[model samples]
Target: MESYKKTNKPRILNIVPISIGSGEVSLGPLYISSALKKAGFDSVVFFPDLSLIMHFPIKYDFIQHQLDYIMKQIRPEVVTFSVLSTNYNLSKSWAEYIKTNFNTTHIIFGGIHSMIEGENIIKLDYVDAVCLGEGEFSLPQYLELILNNKLTQENSLNITYKLKGKIINSKKEQVFLSLDEYPFPDREPLKYYYREGVLDSANFITGRGCPYNCFYCNAAMLNQNKGYLRFRSPGNVIDEIIEVKAKFELKKVIFSDETFTMNKNNLFKLLELYKSKVNLPFECQTRVEAINDDIAKELTNSGCESITLGIESGNEYIREKYLNRKMKNDQIIKAFHILKKYNIRTNSFNMIGLPGDTEKTIWEGIDLNIKAKVDSAACTIFMPFKKTPIFEWYQDKKLIIAEPNTNYYENIVIKHPNLSKLSLFFYSLNFNTLIKLESNKFKRMFKVFLWVKLFFLLFKGFLLKLIKNPLKLIAMNTFMKNYYGRLSVKGIIE
Candidate 1:
């Protein structure tokens, strides 16, 4: 690592999103990693084994080799753990293993999961600090402050020091709003993780947070109750997309933002910019309320060949009353029609058995999803996450059940007092199988291939166990669901 400011530059290492699909992603840590490097810190990245889903039943010994490779070659003075979802445990283990072997290396954990669960995470022996909320703005200045203070006797860095069993969360400053300011994601660098079989996938985040705070999600409250919906200028976004394509050989750039077409002016400008600069295929996740005829056509012209949408429930009552989603039933139908008119491959997400969910509502969702005839449909059971409206809903009703097992967290089926666990599971499974798979994308593109591959992979691993030991799977998923008495089974489709 090169020297900077007469002090040994902090050898910072970032762990990117470890999901088992595509290399060269630019979500949270990857963006922050780019920022840290631009700020002249010696930073390298390590992305753990990517799976289509979060986990597979395999003991990970290769992670040690990768960690050792980073430690020995880069010799980072500070090692940061980027924890997303339950993947924190894997990062925690690596952090502990690294620190155990080398006591001098400092460890800090950052990401949505850590930020929300910091109170629990900081107690672990390996972790030193948790960067709350966004880190591109917080991390750069945080490094400088800690270096100047040099609290050698203190136990923590960046965040409020945890001492004498008293803990404090770092006062978060501001989230970086300027997408132009962020360095182009290191596409070629990240491709090293899985370069050859790379499926020409690129993910870009144009905005953060959601406008409607739903009962089942965390992204809404992830902003700490600040008004939702923040975005970047069109010029900055276009530049980044072009940069990603040129450097990474990207065939499709997916805008992984919550609502890609929220602001009419910015979205139109972005669509125009994308049309002018690149003729690459792309996809995005959006709400039905946001996409009208004009916007759908604009998106299509800009090479939007595929899109994924969240149609949580077909029951209008659940959508409006329970989910905080304000879209009208006709609007959703109209939105699908517009996409279909544009000849775009559409994937609408559906959920079944939300609270007050009768068999009628589940059938409604199935009917709607089947009627839409989207390119694909994704489904999952609702899980109560901390800091969300739904979490409190469960807590208030005294319906909160604690499940010590990790498998339950996957939320395949809603656990409710009114619905038997087996009933919920079978309802979801049958509904999923009902969505007729046309395999249209196989003829049009290969997304269907990936989809099919992921389907079999799930059944091979988790589903296999569920088939053999249905009770175990139900127990695990139900416990992790954290459903209140007669918890509703809400679903998202993006």
Candidate 2:
């Protein structure tokens, strides 16, 4: 283990663990790394691309070698991991491994998972600290104290740490009122590792925090004490986009906010600026209740290429009573119609196997997507997160089939009387198929063709599993070539 004396600047390594099926480059680590660099610290973002290492033995070895190499070479004073709920166990394992190998390095966990599970996470032997809400402000200050040997177990702002076998939580930190104060996220490190060509899009956030209280989400938990939502000025947001466009020559931008159309005034102002100054096509996600004719027109005029709306469940009872969405079916249908009228692509996000969901309700969801005529629709099985109200409800009812895991796409983790695991699996496949069928202009022929494709896809998956060694080698080669090749040509205007 390397020892560090007091130094002017300490090297910090920001690591993002790439879980299977999650390919997007997150902005949390990037923003935190940029903040640290601005405060005179040597910080670099490292993404161990494990997008393809779920079940492959050889790729597992490859990932271990890469982690060992980074720790040996970088020898960072502090190692931070940005984790999601699905990847919490994996992150914990990595933290344990790093502590065993590099005992001197301090370990900090920050992200959605750590924010909600702070008390339990801080008790872990390998974890030294957990940043509760936001890391941009808390992390730099915490690091400075460590460098100057001034850090104590006493309460600090927005940080929780352990000392003398007791956990000490800091005073609550205020949320940043102005988003313009922070520098643009450091994409230089992302450019080296992120597979930009996979989506051909760069992501930016116009704001932090959400005001809505969706039952299944953790946003309400984040806003419980800090009861405010903040947005960047329109001019400031455009300035960052201009800088990013010049640096990356990007084709598309993704406004990855909780709801991009939250503030009508701010949305219109930003749209006007984006129309005149940065005329690049962009996509965003918002709630169904937020869309209107005026908003839809402004979005289209500003080169909005696509829009995704969260129509979580089609059954009004399920949406309002269980999900707390408060959106009616008529509003969702109207929203989709408005987007279609403007010739903008529409995608609907739905969920199946929810707590109150039955076979009838699940089909209703599919029916709504079909009637909406969405260009694309995505359906994910509901996984009750730890801190959400729904998780507690399920626990009390003894409906939870197993602990939360990373398999949200293919597996069902809950046991509902009306919904079996096998039924849910087939429903997921059929839900997707129904959407594709509805999206097709030639519905009759394409429906038949799609079924054929689905059959072949299932057969191929089975064969791949049966011939494990040979198929695994082929799949690994293909994944590597596609991943690296796309990354090489990323951020280039076609």
Q: List the residue pairs that clash in candidate 2.
A: 156-170
lDDT of 1 by residue, 160-201 (tens): 444345565555444345555667555545554335544467
Residue-wise C-alpha lDDT for candidate 2, range 362-428, written one tens digit per residue: 8788778878878877777888888788888888889888766666776567887677665565556
Error of 2 at 365 (Å): 0.7
TM-score of 2: 0.86
lDDT of each: 0.65, 0.77
Provide the RMSD of all predictions against the true structure, rounded to 1 decimal.
7.9, 8.7
Once fitted onto the true fold, the runs of candidate 1 whose alpha carbons sit more than 4 angstroms away are 1-9, 17-26, 49-75, 89-101, 145-158, 163-177, 222-228, 397-414, 426-430, 437-494
Find the number of clashing residue pairs for candidate 1: 12
Best by TM-score: 2
lDDT of 2: 0.77
Q: Estimate TM-scores for all models.
A: 0.78, 0.86
Clashes of each: 12, 1
